[model samples]
Target: MLGRFRRKQGANTQTGVQEQDIGVSNSVEQQGEKPALHVHMPGFNHNGHKVTRGIKPDGESGRGGIHPWHFIRICFRSTSHISMIVNVLWPFVPAAIVIHFARPDLHLWNFILNYIAMVPTANLVGFAGQELARKLPKVFGILLETFLGGIVEIVLFMVLLHNDVNNNLVPVIRAAILGSILANLLLCLGFCFFAGGLLREEQEFDEVISEVGHGLLLMAGFGLLIPTAFYASLRGSIDDALLESKTLNISRITSVILLVAFFIYVYFQMRTHHGLYDSVLEKDEERDRDRHEDLKKAKLTLTECVFALALALTCVSLHAVFLVEEIDYIVTKRGVPDAFMGLILVPLVEKAAEHLTAVDEAWDNQMNFALAHILGATIQTALFNSSLVVIVGWGLDKAMDLNFEVFNIVILIMSIIVVGNFLRDQKSNYLEGSLCILIYVLIAIASWYYPNPAAGTSNTAEGAGTKAGG
Candidate 1:
């Protein structure tokens, strides 16, 4: 009954603030003249392909594509739309420098300051990267951004791997890897669904996007499971040292294959199946309909964006090092569980803020981009970031592998399964989204009590990792 009523009411249609833009003409439309941007932006040719044919804006189709105006347009997007805290977080960036230099002994303060500092710096890196991407071809720009999106996670992993020379930090790195995935799949995605559902009774997204993302995630999860299973099968049959050696060898081999797969998937997303991403095409059109859009233009130039990214990356790298340096102190001295620190606090600081864009997209009924953002970030973490850390561990002689603790492995695979089920219908509501958050809360509590692997334990992670690397 409700479905019928909704169908009659067109409830699935784009709603709110859009009706005013329909069936109306502005001064330019009154004269049957094109908007000023239509004159300069590239246009699509017949058959919906971007090309520049004569002065037709596009080859012959007379449709518009990205242009300089896009850069200007995105520049004006309010930070509030992306993150409420990014604006006020700048002070923490400089404070990180002060706290590190003046009172390095303050492990708690050092950790806290650098941790908070990650937010604004991540914003700058992402904002500038998007700004730069806009200057290139649309498909290539999307490709570049998609491939290079998670600079924070990459830097953090590098810092953690480089510091694990003593081989004690691999478990934290492993937990951090799964934690990042959990944050993306559950915490970030849940908020996107919930926040969007608050305004919309139900939200539907591009199913193709969700399907491809989840497929990749499942594949990556399977790859990780292979290592865990191998470790489990042999742990009881062989010497602990020999089992670690065999597991480490398989992990390195698997890491290489996963990296290859990651690139292949990127090619699939940005090239072969690019049209599947048409969900973004309607995005600007939706925003342009807003009454105040005429006043909007980007504030940064191409050079300015480049400069900002370089500076932002420098700060992000510094903060990551500072934050990682204190993990031992926090876990051992503060009596904080390593699992809790890695699984909850670290990911919350690094990813929880950066992902607000997904939530914003959900609010605006652009579920395709929102879902893509959520899943894409997770795919990168699970496949690319985790694999990179493992390979880098090889180079640095650290024993980083996919053989996470049995409990961490179970939670991660289960989280992916649960989230996949929620997304199977290609639709979401606030209630289902709230359930995701609840599950994450339960996991957080479990992580808090999850004991670190003690010395000479059977776990291949620290005591496990040390033996594994040997």
Candidate 2:
């Protein structure tokens, strides 16, 4: 009996020990699980030792489950995205103001608002062009981007120049044409170089391509120079009507020549010497291979791209109508010279999208792509768009000429020279970029104070001439 009792006591002790081990295991598993719940539920304290009110043993946090601090952090992280949204939507504010006020006399307000509206629409064009280009060969893609990107400026000029038969805006259009070239060559290029240089000590691009682009730019400048020189020589000698007729003839001839040249350029870039522009293609292909899934996700169907392009162009065209209607009034009311409007404001509004793209490419150390974008835009504006404007003007019976003022001609020549020298080396740094930007700023300041000789005189003369001719 004594032995039996001893065994039984031992068994009882072993059973108690087993139960205690199981309890410890259960406690450890619970502890491990609590931290995961705390992570997803912000109401739970970090240590998992405390939970906020109304958060039961289940994993649900208190109402809404998002901490106030967490929401703030998210907003801070997405600040850039928010800025883009604001850029696209802010124009609506001015549009709303215009609707509320409904005052035609508020020309400056109207111009400012309409110009702001152009910016986001221009961005839409850029985005659509990018989408379309993705589905094309690299050389063709660049071409599409260049030509399509420039459509905004061309369309704006067409609408503005065509609206008034007397062509009072001839001087402004000339100034704007030269200004667009300068903005791309100096302002846009300068910013790109600056950004690229800041990101890296040095950046390199294709010298041959740069040289070719410079050659084309020089050609475009010469094309404009001939007409301006002809106008200057004839201005004092001939009567106003005869001089205008001679200028129109010269503009038409020059436009034809420029159109031909632009075609040749396109052929050269796209067919005869496509290899020059295809360096980026090989790298892009390799990248696409590595991130095939990513490329797939980003790709848009052809139909989608076309739809986007059409939609963007429609919006831009509508905005151009409003802008052209108010532009002259704005110039009159604000005492801002038409030359100044063309040189600074118009280009800024029209090319804002391309300007951003060049800077972005530069920041990524893709100097080739950056330089291509700048030069491509410069070429398109100078050769194709300028030529098209003249042709369109003639077709519309407005007879726009390429006769820029002496001040504008001088500025254009100087800008081309400065940029040519900078690009000759085929390499860039931050200092060079800073110098370009400084030069542009100085030019902008000079233009601001520069009086418009035609602004006061031409309006009266054009009115009288129209009456006499009629």
Candidate 3:
């Protein structure tokens, strides 16, 4: 009896180990490994049960678990792959439909011609930075873009300022400033912050970007202060002849002086914040140390570069010329006020498409590059574009002394304040986005209802323009 019990115990121990490996039920082991109680997991069976090979248990997934990050990356890649189609179709289809149905006197052909000429030049100026960035290191790329963009804007404005169209310098300058400011604040910054939030768990901008933002905020503050000073001077009866055409030459001289001083200040401040040689030095060092000598041969083909440049130029030129006309017409003829157009419609129209670029960059984890592009673009729009418009307006027959209607004044002030707050914090949230959108709306409303220049109203921008031109 003892020998028999020993043998049975050994057999039972072997069966239990085999059952565990095959995932057999406990009931089967208890029933002495009966065939009827056996369940197979492909090529393995308990007791005398027949198990077929290549058969998995019900509800067992063949695919392994995927990482959350991997899934998200895949989704982003997929979305980007199809983005171009949507971009081209979304704007054109709707516009074509509208034109077909509305049948307005605005001939698409003339609009196209004006758009092609004006907008492309602006784009070319913008693309100068991109070209610089691609050829040089990132930091210098930004500075190059900013400075060159300013030069391009100035040149173009000079050309247009002397043009024989409506020949109203003031409106052209005002429109340019309006377009530039709106583009920077609403589209560029807004999209950057939004995309950053969505793509990154917690996005953090680099020190360089932070410094740039700070500089922008300071400039905005100075811009506001300039207007305040003008108002005070005018109210106090400083110079009755100061604003007259007789003093136009003197005004231009003053404008040049003030502008030069402001530029010098900005230059010193930038150099202090960001060491001048860092970006260039780093690029040189990297090139020197590179192990793969063959990689130096690799560059984007000239043809490809030219095509991209052309496309960008075409789009921008349209934006600069025809888009402005459309916007002006819509506001003047169709009851959309300047402020509303500047604050809302302009931003939405100009930026909505551009936001796609940021989103794509963010989704790919190129946070620094994307953010830099966005911020740089904004700065260019503000400092470069707006300044050029005024200078150019001066050249066009007479000084387009832009008077920021009270609504524009409020909008500009609120924009500076909100953007400054946003940058100072630099930790964007949904709440901040809501606040920004709300501010945009409020300014738009105020601009629409606000009266134009009243008797004895001050011309803030013109005063500054005069000071700068002088």
Task: Summing lDDT over every window of 10 consecutive residues in candidate 2, give the lowest-scoring window.
Answer: 459-468
Ranking by lDDT: 1, 2, 3
| Cα lDDT over the full model 2 | 0.71
Q: List the lowest-lDDT window of 10 residues for candidate 3.
A: 55-64
Model 2 over residues 1-470: C-alpha lDDT tens digits? 99999999999999999898778777878888532232454444323434444332221222243355643332222112322553555456458346525976776666667777777667767765765565466788878887788989998888867776575676667778988998998888898889888867887777756898899998999998987788776666768777767777988899999989989999998998898678754553343222333232322334544655786688778777777777666666566776787888778788877887677667766677777888999888888888888888888777677877778887898888889999888889888888888988887888888766642143222332121122
- Model 1 per-residue lDDT tens digits across residues 1-470: 99898886775454533554443436568889865542455455334545444322211222244345554344335334555446467889899889899999899999899988987777777666554554555445545554455878888889988888567778778888999999989888888889888987998776777888899999999988888889877776887788888899999999998889888988887778777575453453264223233223333554556666778789989999999898888877787787887799878877743476667667767677667767878888888899999988898777788887788888988988998898899899999889999999999999998877665454654354322233
Cα-based TM-score, every candidate:
0.80, 0.75, 0.58
Candidate rank order under TM-score: 1, 2, 3
**Whole-model lDDT values for every prediction:** 0.74, 0.71, 0.46
Top candidate on TM-score is 1
**Residue 357, model 3: Cα distance from true site in angstroms:** 3.4
For model 1, state the Cα shift of residue 66 in Å.
22
How displaced is residue 144 in candidate 3, in Å? 4.7
**Runs in model 2 with CA error above 4 Å?**
1-105, 238-240, 280-299, 455-470
In candidate 3, stretches whose alpha carbon ends up further than 4 angstroms from where it belongs are: 1-104, 107-132, 144-169, 175-179, 199-201, 224-241, 244-300, 318-320, 323-331, 342-355, 362-367, 451-470
Show where candidate 1 strays beyond 4 Å: 1-78, 81-84, 137-139, 279-295, 461-470
